[model samples]
Target: MAGKRTNSNLAGELLIELRRDDAVPLHRQIEASIRAGVRSGRLPLGSSLPPTRAIAADLGVSRGVIVEAYQQLVAEGYLTSRPGGYTQVAIGPEPAAEPVRTEPKRVPRIDFGYGRADVSSFPRAAWLRSIRRVLTEAPNDRFGYLNGRGVPELHDAIADYLNRVRGTSADPGDVVICNGYAQGVSLLVQVLVRSGAKRLAVEDPSADDDVRPVAVAAGLEVVGIPVDRDGVRVDALDRTDADALVLTPSHQWPTGGVLSAESRAAVLKWAGDRGALVIEDDYDAEYRYDRAPIGAMQGLAPDRVVYAGTASKTLAPGLRLAWLVVPRRLVGDVVQAKVAADRGSPVIDQLTFADFLSRGEFDRHLRRMRPVYRRRRDVLLEALRDRTPGLEPAGIAAGLHLVAWLPDDLSETAVVETAARRGLGVYGVGPYRMSGGGPGGLIFGYSTLSERTITDGIAMLAEVIDEVRAG
Candidate 1:
């Protein structure tokens, strides 16, 4: 019934006038008018035309004439109709610009880049069950904007889990749930800047690629300390005037070096003496392949160290759940920062995670994943050892990846490029390095790839290395 108008009003809106003297049939004139309307944008896409009976009465023609014209336009792709739905303009007469075709790039067969987890193993069934339980039993108050710190249940769960598992001195009040480690770092940087802090130090070869840029954005200068076989060089701490330092002591990222007891103690003593803060990023602490991994550094001096952990490593990163064990003194400022930043993370996810943790489901998931990841790590290390004797693979003790240090003759770029040509993807730590240069190395992540794929990929890489050597 659209455009239900008198004879005079119909001509301006639909712009259709039967040309009897021109020898054109009435149906053809109607069809031509509609076609012109579509091309001129008069009847834009999704616009409904008048019903057949209404238009036929206005034009003093039979309804079959209008129907025939509409049917022809529909067949020509200018109109569309659905079952029990309105007949609307389907497309413009002139089609959209077609994208130009170019040569398609080939995808790599095997990738060993860092920061990837075995997401295929995500606990979908268990998570769904937990979500169902939360939805069915959670109180009405749980969904409201009750706390800026996070859901109390999640706060308690995270604090208790950290104290018991990571050996950190955490209390429910001192925990703050964040979107992820990225937001946690940003919030910490903001809080530190407000406290008159100006400079920060990070490990030279850590896997955390965002901390330096985040710190610089907050107007803090970053100084990279060199990492040796025994973790960071603590003796060099006296040389720089850093307000704080971020350390991955449990299992140092990329380099795979554990902070020796001497360096650990030295760093703590230096922090205490210099009145500096230490942010301990417990990245991938749960997947330690060897014997039990080292405890968190925050346990040594809770007042001076801020412990940060995320579910992104254990669970899927898409979950966006992370927690920080703030010192009692800094709790107020940290919570204020969280309030300014998104208020708080989603409540339902927090509650579901709380339920997941309280039921010991998280522990079970980690236990199931450890052995699987260990086997993959072992396979990667064994293959690299047999195939590429020149490349030395280190840091196989813990975490998801191992660092293969290339000989001085082979650059990181050469190994990576040669491997790519053979359908293998490998990463270099050069991007992670700061001004202080470190030995060239490739980081191999094996958390997601299968054993057969790992073996074949490493074999192919061996062939590529041989070709590189031959040339």
Candidate 2:
């Protein structure tokens, strides 16, 4: 049995006896066994652990039981994750392997770093049909550079949708299309900074470490405004002459609380009082689980709020489609920023997406993804409550992933180390810091994962946690 897995004597199989005791939690016990497997190298370097479903099926236990166990392992640094799957022994017990090859940077298995649209359930078939019809009626040899400001029809369609749906004071003329939110973010920042707004206030708990740097690179000073449970505390605005602020008023990233009406009004009033501007990231706006989405803040104060959003969350990030709704006065400046940056995006993408949204396929896509994400959210909740001990997930109602705060004694580094050992792509929320301690937690993205994967993945995570707790 040199390199073969012998179920009876192997560490991965020792869990059968551990499960016999009903008093002990199955996940922790399973975790202990997995740890033994790693230490002994019965699960050799770069080896794959049975996924949660496989483990659950073998143990005749619920997948949630497995999810809890895996969560512990992820916390313990016994797993490393990849997109679509994770590897158990990829990181290995030691730096024992010799260099066998050289490679470019490995794309992360699960990219929790970037906020993405849950497009797994997008109405692709319907979208394809629309594209087919449009293409069929098109002129021959039709592949040419598109209109500079996006197709007229798509702009009109997006205008109608935004005004009706999000309640922004946007006409087709007011909207400037770009490749995605990042581009929109950069363009808007340049316009304001170029307009003499030197400093911009932002939330500490935010997704755009990129945006802040992007702003700086575009020649604006970045300032932090702490976010309260109700949203960015308006009172915390940097006490300077800064004239612009960036916020996700609808669903704040990472923490996932909507701006309270009081807070929302306060921010608007601040903008008005200071004659400042607001950069609104309407991120993950459509997928609300526990409550209806609070209407976009742009609706409340049209002149001061510069609304920005993208199809990255609702459709696929690959579409690279997003919009910036600047005040009528800022349009020329922002469009110029766009023109300078990339001479406008591929005209065809704008045409296709505008057609996609206008025909109502985009809305249909959102509706389809809502229930799927809701189910995944529920599964995550149930997994944590029933299986994950000492772990808590906040921001439950919306967004693709939930943030799980680790216990006070848990080391973020250890959690990361344990996850690497197991091939689980777990990340600490504050690990992205240029400076400062963030809430010690993992941002578990559940959108791209199937239920079984979520169940299994969480089980892997639970295992790391159990190992750490025992230590």
Per-prediction TM-score, please? 0.80, 0.73
In model 1, which range of ten residues has the least summed lDDT? Answer: 3-12
Q: Could you say which candidate leads in TM-score?
A: 1
Across residues 1-471, which tens digit of lDDT does each residue of candidate 1 receive?
455333343335778978778888888898899999888877777677777878888888899999999899899898887766666888865765799999898678898867767899999889999999999999999888865689999988888888899888888998988999999988999999999999999988775566888889889999988888668888777676899999988778878888877788889998999899999999788888776668888889989999999988888889999988888999889888999988888999999999999999999999899999999999998898888888898888888888999898887888888888888999898978886467888899999999999999889988887787787
Off by over 4 Å in 1: 1-106
Alpha carbon lDDT of each predicted model:
0.86, 0.75
Supply the global lDDT for candidate 1.
0.86
**TM-score of predicted structure 2:** 0.73
Q: Per-residue lDDT of 124-243 in model 2, one digit per residue for the tens?
A: 788787777667755443356543456666679888898888877777888888888888888888778777878877887777665888888877878777775567767777354578
Model 2 gets an lDDT of 0.75
* Residue-level error in angstroms, candidate 1, position 403: 0.7
Alpha-carbon deviation at 367 in model 2, angstroms:
1.4
Relative to the unseen true structure, what is the C-alpha lDDT of residue 203 in candidate 2, on a scale of 0 to 100?
80
